[model samples]
Target: MATGSVKIDVHHITRVEGHGNIVVDVKNGQLKQCDLEIPETPRFFEAMLRGRPYMESSHITSRICGICAIGHATASLRATEKALGVEPSAQTVLLRKLNFHGEMLDSHILHAYMLVAPDLLGAPSVVPLAKAAPDVVLRALRMKKLAGDLCAAICGRHTHPIAMTVGGFTHFPSKADLEALRQRLIEARADVDATVELFQKLKIPAFERDTEYIALSKPDEYCFIDGVIKSTDGGSWPVEQYRQVTNETCVKHSSAKRTRHQRESYMVGALARVNVNFDLLHPKAKSAAGALGLKPKCVNPYMNTVAQVIEIAHCVEDSIQLCDVLLSRGVTWEEPVAPARLSGEGVGACDVPRGTLFHNYVIQDGLVSGANCIIPTGQNLNNIEADMRALVPAILDRRPEEITLSLEMLVRAYDPCISCSTHMLDVKFV
Candidate 1:
């Protein structure tokens, strides 16, 4: 163990996305402290959303994060729909789910094979992975492209697609387009299988801490689109009751609001989803989990990469099934009836690739009176800091560079969409 004091600071973490910092303090062989600071200026998305047309909420909120634009779009639409008491047709619902699956698969692959894998493999970036292991990288990119293709088929374009609207879609994909997508996803199953196997083979550092994992859980199905907010600690409430279960408090140390449950910090994201909905996963996902020796209750945060890969496979399978249904029954493009009266409040929550995303809205005179969005990255900020506090003590004796690398690796595992939480902007470390 080293004697004196060592302070390691990582400001403006690069490569992945968003703005944040990780600081570790050590003294006299004991870890003194750690802080995960979110200096990314808040855009006051909720504050800015006041008085916009209710119908435009989805479009406006989708700009929160470029990487997860579709996720934000879907969550915002779900909340707006709830507030207006409007439900889209069955076909619209299925299409929305397909869009979400594509976004998840796309984001997960980017994180697993591109952003996160380089750290584990001691490479600088995925570019090198492409050069060194061209075949592996190509396969991974193909799977990622499939995800993009899925999104394009349903939403019209892969990035920030504009087809989604409140009540129902402005247009629906043709039957032939849907069938082609289904066929492509079916062919990519082997790639997903390989990705899952690759994740299982990677050596994940053991950093386990008992945390309250929060996610969405429905009674009959694995929740991606809708469900009640649930936690591993046996605490749950309806989506509307989220403000009661989780409290957001601001600290002088960071720009991002810290979230706590029962006065103790909790975590939400892929790990939370998998732990809360292990049984709800598609049978193939469950089988993959089993093959990887993952239990229903996974505690190690690093294992989230595996969970994400499993989810990608599940999403592909689910999309295929949904396409099969659409082919048999067909779809209709119908706009929902504009609300006869539009003065009310509603809340919505969905499980994003990162975690549970909550949106609340107040609609008056057919316009958005007010809006509040609680993103997954903001929810996990406090928990990430807590984990750092616990981890620094274990690795304080190592070289400063090694310690810094380890800490950064831990943060990347979350695959945070920081830009979404705080409007899109460059993250600065200081």
Candidate 2:
């Protein structure tokens, strides 16, 4: 290990959804501190939910994150429906799944091409890459547009969807619109192959640290919007017991909470889902994984982006099948399912683009009295720190600038939704 004294302080890390800082210190060839500090103040979405009409929970909570709005809406609706005893129709389930596919595609494509690609290609951001590789940028934009249009066709818009609600959707896409979307998804396969090729050529950092992986899983399907919370560490818990699984505790360094379960830290996201439900992936996605050299039980956090690309392929193929099913069955107008009762407590969970998201609500006399939501990023903070601690020691021989880039890449690999903004890395040698 070649180290004297090195310090890296990245103020407001770029390309993520929220604000966070990376702080590292080393002295006399020994690591002293490595931390991913989250300074963004709490938004208090759960507190905001109390005293609101039960019907409004989904809409209000959807405002939590534009990237995860559909996921929030779906989870919020499930909690409300379960508390109120409303069971959506089969058609509703299919439509909601299709809407979810749109979001998965939208978010994954944005991250893979726009956010993370810069690091892999050694550019500052996608803007420079546009001039360097125009076709790749155009491909990303095309796929993103298709994802957005798909969401609009189903949920009345991608970000903070307006159609989705507690019992069911307030709007539905026409057959013509769905058929057009299906055609586009079919056409997008070429781009999907191109994506696989792009990632295959770019090398991911060779690093592995075994950690517990968690996600929503079903025995028969690649569960996304619903299922039991399962962990690779050897147990499954219903979403109701998420508190036990998460074991969230406050940390002095972060305004956001840190979580641990079955270990000091557990990971959730595309890699977790892939490890937990590899068999359930669509056949084409499995093939993509093979080509990309990703397999179940992968521990490299850097490979999460590859897992995301694999999921993108899965979303496209499965969405086409869902479209075919809807077109074949012929959607019919149906009233939104009404609650059988007004007072009960329920929890809902979904494997969102980021990871497993949980929303719990207690409804009393048609008003929400209590609420709890655990975001993926909150669940991941501790794990990110754990990774940083492990990584810094191993790379102590590298120059300070190279070490700084590696740490930045490590954080960006997790794709933490801390906030949206980029800032410079400030290093101090003491």
Candidate 3:
């Protein structure tokens, strides 16, 4: 708010998971309040996990987000495995990495093509893109299909995977099967490169906000399946210490809780990962990042879309490398990871598509006694609104449609899976 009055109320932002709204109130050039309100009824996924058997918790929590089903399931499995004192074999870890890479590819391609592409292309949705940029749309579809097939090969289903379990997969893909999938991945590299080049041409706004970045960090490579929680402010903690870093608090404007570290806001997802671990990116992804003019320590929220494009390249190359390792070592079909009756607490932390996700569990005699799952979207809720607060003021002089588009694009950049985080609240009458 500077010289005039404006009101922007956008309900249920399009091309994102679940429902979210942007609300802004300004009067006489004074900012009253600006918020991204997710008033969706809390989904209560935590409560659902409680009292469920360790083997069933992943299957139950995997329902939190249709787009991120594998991430949720992976987190749940890691937590259950840890609490039950189960350690997966080397082959299991490698296979899980493959599954993780596939999840990343699946979600990133969907966001880049189906959700974020229309905004840059000036199309209402992907439907029009089919008519306008038929080849581009077709390529995106092929990329998505290829990634989905990888999931099916590894997890036994494209959407909600059935093969993943507590300590290991119920079924492992044969060498011949993995080799086939590897060939498809190798073939898809050209398309992934095209995607990076495509996003490079998009018109992303130039806006910068200095904030803390958080993600899972490892010493050897870009972490996906496991790593310690890290913050850009030089704070490092184990997954079980998440309560200290997240410092989650309730806000009346949204059902999803907001998170903060040393500052009022912190960013997660691809941007944070790139900011922290750019060196570990696969060679192909690193080249894509350079081509797109993206470098480490990027602070612009709008560049998150670019970061995602870079991440797509990384996931693809990483997937190929994982395939090489699996084949060289040879895969073995081991017994499904079965958990023994135990009483303890454990936390599973991993880099999901949206960002770093944590699933903490307290198990009593092999049944989940309590659960807490922190999703990337939930962590970035405060940051998104904070970006909005900064953005609307800068573009207040622009047209209303421009303002709305800016805000909507900001949210879409997060590729938020709102449904994954909605169920983490408890309310009582005051």
Candidate 4:
């Protein structure tokens, strides 16, 4: 009889936001089990939101995730607009896309340089990268700042901007302000180019798992702002029908709800979006995707960082085009009508940097009666665990410390935002 035993566990993961754990058990020459746990702590975001004025939902929900504040805010606004029965003007849509792109860029850079790259480069943190390659670190900072500036210009603040509203922005950007942003984005094109090259050269782990990819899709052009929910397996449903496709259920072991579609776990985020809408990507984005060797469907989760960099370039290029359109036509703003009687249900979804985010609302009178928010992290949780399962057997022979590091690195590759996943709850590990 053969006998062996190994166990790897991470009690508290640092350097990445939120709280979570990875546990692996090996026995008798076969992997025993792998469990990913999210501790439950109740924040009561939905319960507290009950009876709040519809206009305030954006501000309130924006608190759900600090890392993706703009995403939450944008989702809230879209829901409120649906409840209020208003479609924002063209300029409003463009401006909102710009703000979202900035947030996406900020998030992608943070994940690429700060979270994921360190592991690939064998560094504990980006601090070492900052010392060894000051220029690289500085470029990341500059790119991040550009994203912040774009967010500030559109929403009045980078972290938790309050300028976004249901109908349209509370304020509009001046021509000079818009022009300055345009020029800055134009100048930063080279930086974006460099970033693409930098990510392409990084060595990523070889762990490939196939899962259904989901993202928003439109008939023409990349569907970043609005579109029906689409999947790589040729399954799609309207945005309003997302709940029918996505079923969230509670697991005894996890504080975060496990999401599955048709009884199978699925994947979302940059790779999913890139896979589902490769044809719809902006021309420059298409070029970058080609350069990165990303196909119509990308299965390796580790390559998500590369897809994110391609997306950054796409967003910057798209922003420049949007600015050109805005400058040529001049700035225009219009306030939409507020729905007086709001007894209805509506759904809204957008392509955040991580993945597809869905928001559903049940409104009564002029207040939000019930709200359900499905973030990308929740969708990717099961997939992350599955990847960990596949990775453990291969690394079981390695030292415990090495095994732990590999497991943690795999988690970071998903770029899981635990705060966003458990927005309505407080996390506590038992």
Candidate 5:
């Protein structure tokens, strides 16, 4: 190992959701300080949910992230519905799953194409990649547009959805709209295959560290909207026990709180989900994973990008099936289910594009008396640091620029939404 005094100070990393700095120091062949410092201010989403009417939490908290807004809204609605003792109809469930698939396609494509692809392609950003690989960029844009339109057709818009409510949706997609979307999804398989091939050609760094993986787990299907919180560490918990699994605590360097469960840190996202639920993936997605050389129990953080691409295939294929199911059953208009009771406590969990997200609510007198939202990025922050601590030393022999790039790629592999992670604090300032 050829290491003297080395310091890497990235003022702010690019190609992520929000602000964060990577600060590393190594002295005389000895590692010293390494931290992924998050400086984004806390967003107080939980506090804002307090005292809001039960019907409003979904719409309000969806603003937590423009990218994962549908995920947030879905989780928020689940929590509200459970708290108020409202069970969604079967039709509602199918539509919500399709809507969730739209977001999964939108976000995974955005990250895999616009954010993480630049690093693998040796470009500064997607702007350069667009010029150099116009066809590739156009494919990404095409898929993204389809995903957004899918969301708009069902949920009224891609960003913060307007139609989804506590028990059901305000509007349903027309048969023509659903049929058109189904056709488009069927056509997108070639693009998804191209995406897999592109990543297969690009070399991901060879790095691996065994860490615990966690995500929402369902026995019958690959999970997203609802499942138990399952961990690779060999335990499962209901959504209500998420606090025990998360164990979020404040750290000195980051405004975002660090989380741990059964280990110093654990991972939650595409890699984790793929590891925890690989057998449950759709056959096409499994083929994509096979093509990308991604298999269960994958430990390399960089391969998270690869897993995301696999999920895109899954989303497209699954979306087509969902469209078929909906068409066969026929879309029927139904009134939103009213709350059977207004006083209860409930927790909701969803496997978003990022990872397992949890929302807990306490309802009293038809209003939200308390709320807690554990973001996927927040859950992954500590694991990122853990990965960094392991990775920095292994690559210390490389030049500073190379080291910095490796670290940047490591962070981007998580596809973190930092602003969403920094949502809530347990401190009171005088």
Candidate 6:
């Protein structure tokens, strides 16, 4: 048995969506190597779009990740439209933003209740939590179900949406449907407040690193649907100039590519969004952030989970407001925006639940000639490794079990969808 050194190989971390290995080796307290290895094979989502009709591109790419199906679909449609130079109507933009909020609520609820709750409560899984804290679990299930209904009302399905298209939705939700969803969200406000209270009492670990943060930002609001890519390092770039900032390079250990922006590693997702666009958050969400002691330039990665909590407040309230507007305007049956020409190229950047997602496409003669997607988890992989590099040595004196749990919790904090990041590294627009 090795006594003076620590050797840990946590193969396939639990609770996260896909396979990854966390390998750390320390010999006589001298750090040897620590790597968060992405061993899963790549899924070539972009290549699949080749030769497909531009209309079908959104449908095919929406299958990229079940949790981020709306994000993928939204980004894909935006790219398709930009290529064809057809601007969506004001109603279309409103409904699409609402559609994304539904996904944010649904996906965040799962991460908070189903995944992170077990770790926080010292339970093995949500199954045990159902017995240990049935009320808490029930609230989550109710909220999740309601959120799913919101998405389905707008997009025709939750997991893989069908109604949303490149130019606009096939049809808008009925007045009755919007009214019912508004009522459900009103009823769920108490549940969201309960969640805030829960997070307020839980003890999150203390760890901080001043990493560069990036997200999409636009005028007068938090731009989830459309924006320029802005970095906290005081650099902002157009969506088309994404490659200049991403600087994505293939790595030996990760099937997912590593990325850097203005520094060695930068973070994305809720924390980055909060850090960059704190002023634009809904008042309730801003209040939640204030209560949680999460201010701008917050360096602690663990607080990413807290940022997510704050966003739940925002998503619910914003969705309600969106619903009110849609109801007042009245739902209307509209056809998808027709393309001006078959040959064009465009790129889209949008804020998802996790972070900024990029989709670039070239439509040649009514078919998608090429495509590329940049995933949030892919951007965070290097940042997570950087955190581990700093963390392990500080906690080396602690028991092995404690160290292992801390690392796992750190990864869980990001709420990473690994399979979503398993996109191919080498992509060339045709």
Q: Give per-residue CA lDDT, model 2, range 1-430, as digits (tens).
A: 8757787777877887777778888888787877777777677888889999999999998888888788889999999998999999999999999999998899999999999998899889999999999999999999999999999998899888999987788898899998999999999999999999999999899989999999999988899977899999999998889999989898787788888999999999999999999999999999999999998899999999999999999999999999999999988777899899999999989998889888999999999999988888788878888988898888888988888888888877887787411101222222
lDDT of each: 0.80, 0.88, 0.85, 0.80, 0.91, 0.88
Worst 10 residues of 2 by lDDT: 420-429
The clash numbers for all candidates, in the given order, read 4, 6, 1, 5, 0, 1
In model 4, where is the ten-residue run with the lowest total lDDT? 421-430
Q: Is candidate 2 or candidate 4 better by TM-score?
A: 2
Of the candidates shown, which would achieve the greatest lDDT relative to the real structure? 5
- Can you write out model 4's per-residue Cα lDDT over 310-346, one digit (the tens) per residue? 8888889988988898899898666754664567666
Model 6 collision count: 1
Worst 10 residues of 3 by lDDT: 421-430
User: What would the per-residue lDDT of candidate 6 be over residues 28-55, giving only the tens digit for each residue?
Assistant: 8877877888878889989999999999
Model 5, stretches more than 4 Å misplaced? 424-430
lDDT of 6 at 391: 86
Model 2 CA RMSD to the hidden true structure, in angstroms: 2.1
lDDT digits (tens) for residues 188-226 of candidate 1: 988978887777778888888888889999988888877
Q: What C-alpha lDDT does candidate 2 achieve relative to the native structure?
A: 0.88
> Comparing candidate 4 with candidate 5, which one achieves the higher TM-score?
5
125-234: candidate 3 lDDT, tens digit per residue: 99998899998899988988888888888999868889999888888888998899889989998898789879888888889888899999998989887788888889
Where does candidate 2 clash, by residue pair?
A: 17-419, 17-420, 18-418, 18-419, 19-418, 19-419
Show where candidate 6 strays beyond 4 Å: 1-3, 424-430
Q: Write the per-residue lDDT of candidate 5 for residues 1-430, one digit (tens) a residue.
A: 7668778888778889888888888888777888888888898989998898988899899999999999999999999888888999999999999999999999999999999999989889999999999999999999999999999999999999999998899999999999999999989989998999999999999999999999999999999988899999899998889999999999998999889999999999999999999999999999989999998899999999999999999989999999999999999999999999989998989999999999999999988899999999989988988998898889888998888889888999999998899842111100
Query: Candidate 1, 190: how far from true, in Å?
Result: 0.8
